[model samples]
Target: MKHKYAESDGTTRHVWDVERIWKLAEDLEPFEIHIEEIRGLDSVTWFYNGDEPTVRSVSRHAGRILNADTSLPPILTEDFRVFDGMHRIARHLMEGTSRILVKKFSTNPEPDLIEKL
Candidate 1:
């Protein structure tokens, strides 16, 4: 997304920015997760494995979900690969909710790849 920032010259410049990310919380699109879809999907987070989410974290997020807090950012994915927010999704599944909220990133790039650079 592009955002306009005011310049000292009394002009504004539109540039690529995180406005899209900022919108995810409020503009969640229904993300369908079939039981089969969760199987063998890859995690983008460096420390994440396919293991079940911890009860503590899941419980905490369940509260947020229950409270209807849009502050809970949507899980990001691309091409059926989960890069973040796995815990939130797990909590939804545990609650027997078939659909979750998500924001899909088109780049679908590995963040760790930048650190290696």
Candidate 2:
């Protein structure tokens, strides 16, 4: 299904620059996570896991997902475990911007590999 993400009318202006984006680039940029081995939420059998978000230090990490509005890299993690470049996707959705650049990484991502972003 298609998601028509439109922001509130008569709202504040939105910014497209990712250089100094305190939300994603500034906070989650140069990001890295193990996608191949990162177990799924339901697969983990520990005391905490699943959609509940077991990771304890995920405040900053999750903030990036919640506030995001741009097209992000094709989910590097197994199933969207860690969302890189998500802020821009979120913002774009709210602002009705078309298209977003996303980079797909391998098991061991190459630091030099970068798309238009």
Candidate 3:
């Protein structure tokens, strides 16, 4: 099957094959409650700065992040967050990856990042 472009929003309503998508989600290994996307911008703004978003530098590329076999340390703690996959999860934020899937842990949340994807 071809990789499809999703809205990056949590609403996967328009999708035609629910079972297939669900299976794809399963292929992701352990599906967790990814709430970051639903929580929106202000919630994650502090986590994402400019140059330091994606932990990898321009020369490193996404390949490095994917290639690293080590376990990633948590970024979003009580004080800070990680962008870079190799470094802290808060180190890398170079577009395309801002919309992340997180396990929802809050009852109430804020608006989605209208300015971003």
Best by lDDT: 1
Model 1 off-target regions past 4 Å? 1-73, 110-117
TM-score of each: 0.39, 0.26, 0.23
Give me the overall lDDT of model 3.
0.31
User: Which portions of model 2 show Cα errors greater than 4 Å?
Assistant: 1-75, 78-82, 108-117
> Which pairs of residues clash in candidate 1, taking residues 3 or more apart in a chain or in different chains?
none
Whose lDDT is higher: candidate 1's or candidate 2's?
Answer: 1
Residue 4, candidate 3: alpha-carbon lDDT? 20
Ranking by lDDT: 1, 2, 3
lDDT of each: 0.44, 0.36, 0.31
Model 2 agreement with the true structure over 1-117: per-residue lDDT tens digits: 121111113443222222222233323333433333332323422224244544664555456556774435433322343223444444444565554444333342212222231
lDDT of 1 by residue, 32-78 (tens): 44633553334333223364567876566567556553335444544
lDDT (tens digit, per residue) of candidate 3 on 1-117:
242212224433122232243333332332232324322224433233365555545436445544543333222211222221222223324333444433221221221222232
Superposed Cα deviation of residue 46, candidate 3 (Å) = 14
Query: Where does candidate 1 have its weakest 10-residue lDDT segment?
Result: 108-117
